[model samples]
Target chain A: MPTRNDMLLLTGFVAVVLAAPFLFEPIGAGYPDLLQKFAIFGIFAIGFNILFGLTGYLSFGHAAFLGVGSYTAVWTFKLLSMNPLPAIVLATLFGGLFAALIGFISLRRTGIYFSILTLAFAQMSYNLAYSVLTPITNGETGLQLSQGDPRVLDIAFGRDYGAVLPSSDLFGLEMTGYPGFYFCGAMLIVCFYIALRIFRSPFGMMLRAVKSNQNRMNYTGLNTRPYALTAFIISGMYAGLAGGLLAVTDPLAGAERMQWTASGEVVLMTILGGSGTLLGPVIGAAVIKYFENIFSAFNKSMLGDIFSFLPESLQSGAVSVASLFVGEGWHLTLGAMFVLIVIFLPGGLMEGIRRIGALARRKKPGGGASASTPAE
Target chain B: MASILTVQNVNKRFGGLKALDNVNLEIEAGTVHAIIGPNGAGKSTLLNCFIGRLEPDTGTVIFDGVSLLGIKPHEINQVGVSRVFQTPEVFGNLTLRDNVMIPAFAKRDGSFRINAWKGVKRETDIEAKAMAMLENVGLARKADEIAGQLSRGDKRRLELAMCLVQEPKLLLLDEPTAGMARAETNTTIDLLKKIAETGITMVVIEHDMHVVFSLADRISVLAQGTVIAEDLPERIKGNPKVQEAYLGGAHL
Candidate 1:
């Protein structure tokens, strides 16, 4: 059970997530598709942070769980129904089981060895899903509700499978545009709440201990392995939930989802936003997704339009330079940002924000001796 | 008194080097048993055997009538044997209070417990007990501080608090006062003496004769992977073999 403070934090977080679409409108990212992507990837990053951030065990193969979740959800749609609820449930359960299997083997080693094991497992899964498991995973064409698929529950609901491709839904609520974004957003909030509970619990302390000093923790009378394995499984299940939501929103499960790059994207999100902080990964996900979708669309003409206020010659020069940072070159900007964050804010964006807050507090005229006590 | 820990005919080797050779020890309950020697005396290697960090090739180590040979290090701790490292191994990333609280929680919940849903704030009894231990270590003011930022002496005290919080049956110290100034070493001696008065058995490995003499009730001198002498602190000080192997070389 959450305490009163926990309840309040959850309530506040839910409000922000619910209001995100409207809040993001002025920033040009409020569209349902991008918003949905934000929520789904936010869940992925949060889950990734539970293992990487808290436990300091960086598994470079979380995409395996994500791909597993997507495949399970797609399979559920093909065999059971178009209703996303059951698909999500199965995806989470299967994702946890897969994580447990992988964690049992991979957690035997520490540091880079553990990461390499997870990476190897993810690559194996990707290859299997693409080639050998083509009959089930549908190869490069991806898994979908085909004309001949036996959606037993959908058929019983009086839906015509012989007609057009079925859109995912929550009962009669069509999962697209506003409704779909809200569904994904709600799931993000729920995942965040679970993460919050784990953070405040004794289990979280053990994980931190594992991260801080596993050898010391061993002598302190903690089996450390179980704690790390539990963290890995929980994070894997979170990734799976995100993957399930991806299938729910788009209705396709691809083997590419399990690729190492997909795993790297979530790691980038966690570190860019601040790995250990609660709200850091969510913000990092939002920033990265926004750059990937919105910033990548900026062309020479759009840049020219924004720089029109300057003189004609200066505008042309600025557009050429800015174009290198956006559009097809947006990764340059991302790389530079990553470098700056790593060098200046080793703790990530959260640490930068903390320093800024401290400086501002110190600059306040009323601040005196107590302000000099040093921030924790 | 009954033996709290019994190591019988233990032998360990790394290829050609004998880390411990036919080492036998019987630690009486409720006593401070200090092991002293020069470098390469296998003090740490012998300590490792007790904590399950290293397995003796052929030996029997029984703690409270339970065999500790096959058990893991954490299991040894759960069975009431804890070790303090030479460099003061601690959860440096966590707060001093948390560093102590973790051991208290470990003692209460055994080696492993899934208490993810229960809030740490709700574990008031644990928090209070941890706080009291911090106070006992003279780190009450620094309890909220990050443990990594503490001075060397304080870190040692914090480690002592962490071990004492578990209330272990046997506390093993490996150079507990290593890298300490004269004053800090004296403070640690006093602290160990205070902990000793509680009747908890301690097997301390130290090069610092000052610390050894101040707290040890019985002393064992190890020379070249073997126990050359075992007697009261005064008797071991005068032993000819001990003097040649260790005490004489120390310029004491």
Candidate 2:
């Protein structure tokens, strides 16, 4: 949150971000593209947090819904028009429907086994999309638009149904880069607000109840499986929406996007930012997307040039060591981040921030929060 | 008075041992009934059966007009029957208010929903009811304290608060003062007496003869799986059959 004060800070931060392309457009960081990816992934991570963070259900197959959504959105383009809005909605629906079916079966188990089931299903989806579902998914090369795209509505309107959108537009409305950026940004805000609402709701309390002491929830006459399943479905729907947005922004859908590795990336994002904390997943999404887009852009030659003034041997070694932190080897950094977070800070980075915040609060008089309070 | 609750032909076997054999009893409404037994007399088993926590191999547990076999514990509570477990199964992670709120929530919310948009404050009059229940059991000041941090005496009071919050017609307490200190035990006995005066029918399983004598309007003494005698406290205290089952065997 940036607070009200924090929100003002964040709003200012976003304003700076929106202006970055104009400020540093000469530099090819693609500030607009970077911001778009951040907002999109932020939505995805927030959805993941609801399922994994709040409910304590570790899902390893979330990528399937994301994939399902992407494929659905692309299919809409192939069958209807390349209108991004319709594709997004249709993709979200397809993702949620797919999730409902999987959640029904997987939520019967919990802990490692539950995670394994979701992972197995996700892998199965990946394999099928890459091969067996070739007719629909277009296989390894991935699904894309063709001239035969039967977007009847677009064709009836005397337009090419399968063509790529011209940056952005609406029916007689001008939409360019900033409008598109604000579109995704507002969606992210909506997603964050919804997650915050659920966190404070009685339904959210029941989910936590299901997480902490499931048996007690059962003994209290709640059929616990239904609650877990519902949460699973909702989270799956979220993944689907994120996937739809990805396809919308890029105008392509790929099997690799739905891989187990991608699923693992989401889990990493949620935990690194802190599970069970409201803004943590969004923060995590932004951090990971930034590193992926910006950090990886630095290559061995760039590193070599930066350290050219150093001795020749030390300069080359610096490139090697820095390369180990990014590019094809970036996962090592991601993995180490998770291990350190799990061992040293099991409550995640959010708890660390909270502790610091508490310390600052203690320096003020009468600022000690009551320990026994349960949030309503 | 016609019995409002009945446990008929109840039998439970754990491998080769018969924990309860053809146990039968009838409990009248508004009476404080006590089940006194030796260590292995299946007092807890009978209590568990009555509460639908453990199914008996053979039995009919009839509460009011409904069969108690397949009903959940909270559903049973909804039907005006509730049990306090032997070890006081309080929610350790919650406060005393939250602990009481749990059973009260069960009564109020129908156990589950997807009310993700509704605020907790507007859910019901839960906070006021939970506070009043705590006040009733003398735990009002400690309502905000974590239940796990409570003293044993306070824990017992907390458990009693949980059971009573639902306003059950039949309240079952299993050894409510089992491990309490002498002072705590007496306080529990006094509390039970005060509760009984309110006309809430109770069935208690107590090993403490002093507390049992102080509370029971009628006592059923069990030896082996079946009741050896059911009488007033004075008669059960002097019965030779009870003497043989307990006094002769050096059992409490």
Candidate 3:
């Protein structure tokens, strides 16, 4: 039931995602690892937007589901086969179940109180996974696949890995390098389609109604709790799927994945890209991940080399100043960018794109008629 | 006609000040019953009790043979009651069509359903009905406009369309013409008259005498948490108690 415009948007988005390697090669983000991170986090942010953007419920503990997904996926790998399918499915289910529990309790309150409750629940999960749940989470050492572990499914199928550790695979194709990126990319596309459908569904309207006026919704004979809770669970499953993908790319589950900072990262991604609009979260995720991987890799020598054309004194001074905003200090750049974006483009990158599109249309003669169409 | 709503021994108190002092009333089906009172006369409090917004200290509110007390607001709504707030509480962020379609979906799918997979645009029947309701309220031209951008009177009409789409058995309106200009008020009156002809029961609380007298089949005058007079609209205007409580003995 997607409109022609929606179908065109989907096709354009798919083309760009599939061509990411070629498109990003000149920017040094063409590597499989960063591309995989972009796709995985893109899924996470899209899910988070479903709840936060539509319903105006800000959950600060979504990383708990992500961590749960990682642990579930790792456990699936250790106990069953190295196949990513079972691992991803179980990870998504556990993530949703955990979200149902947390959403049920946290949704009892709203506004700042709801945010704090989610934070508390997440902090509790982080601590439990870091300490008390050592048997399951492996505590400080983290959970990793080992040769000693049982792979019942693989053994039943008569497949064996003698000395070298087996990586996650689909059928016989190893999910690493470009294949890993493609795997995550496929999942991201499917998730985006589902998110798009939900946005155009009756359920999405109800969520928006919840944000608009809860009193009216109740008076209109629509229960807002179930709607909010369903959004929460759906987002949680998305985070879980992202986590499972993370495990597939690199078969390790660490307690740090459940930390509050990780939860905050997704929020920043959503806000930076545009919380409510389709395609914004993916862009935001890519921008943040790009900064984390590429910007952090810069050193003083790299800055000096870039400023080599300047005089000796000017080059040294530039390096000294520029070094503070890169390498380990790359967060300063991100913080400044976030501040500027919030001030100038409060609706995030999407607003900026819309304004530029508007400006371009205004410059073109006879474009006014089509440009005046209302934005959804 | 049989009564659709009955209230007995309803009492509510806000600390020492009584909001409703053992109020009682019955509204027959298919009639426009107007509750007119001065400011702070507990008319809203009484209406709140019927809609499950407030529970009275001692009372039984029977709507269509079902007790309305101790139930949720949505449960009350599900039992065939719909309310339009005094300030026109429509979904401001949604389109007018979406605003009307939400209640239609709620009515068809009960209180909760996960109709997530189907496209909202594909529900052609509901879309047609919602559009027709908007057209009935003379808002068909601005169907795609955001509800928040509407004028005060237009928003009120939009809210009416939203409620009418639900096809509720009873509609409760609070100050349907409170802030409207004279022309808008007349238009609303005409719309209400057309709706009244369709045979749905309505309970309206209004401070506007012109709206009340023009549309009310029966009138109840309340003052300081007590009903002083209840009769046909023309008869209630002559009652000395109603005159004293409402207009301070001024000739009506």
lDDT of 2 by residue, A1-376 (tens): 2136445645654665556456445545456667777777888888888888767899999989999988988787767766677877887788889988998889889999999999999999999988878988888778776665677767788875244443223453323355555667766776776776677666776777676666555555556777787778778877888888777666678999889999998998888889888778877887777667666667788778888999998988888888887777766777787789889878777888889998888777756665435455
**Model 3, residue B204: displacement in angstroms?**
0.7
lDDT of 1 by residue, B92-113 (tens): 9899989999999999998889
Interface RMSD of candidate 1, in Å, is: 1.0
DockQ-based ranking, best first?
A: 3, 1, 2
TM-score of each: 0.96, 0.87, 0.97
Who is ahead in TM-score, 1 or 3? 3
Stretches of candidate 1 exceeding 4 Å from the true structure: A1-5, A157-162, A309-316, A364-376, B247-252
Which residue pairs clash within candidate 2?
Answer: A2-A6, A2-A7, A3-A6, A79-A151, A80-A151
Off by over 4 Å in 3: A369-376, B247-252
- How accurately is candidate 1 docked according to DockQ? 0.82
lDDT of 3: 0.94
Q: Per-residue error at A121 for model 1, in Å? A: 1.7
Best by TM-score: 3
Q: What clash count does candidate 3 reach? A: 0
Model 3 has a DockQ score of 0.87
lDDT of 2 at B71: 79
Q: How large is the i-RMS for each model, in angstroms?
A: 1.0, 3.8, 0.7
Q: State candidate 3's TM-score.
A: 0.97
Worst 10 residues of 3 chain A by lDDT: A366-375
DockQ scores of the candidates: 0.82, 0.43, 0.87
Ranking by lDDT, best first?
Answer: 3, 1, 2
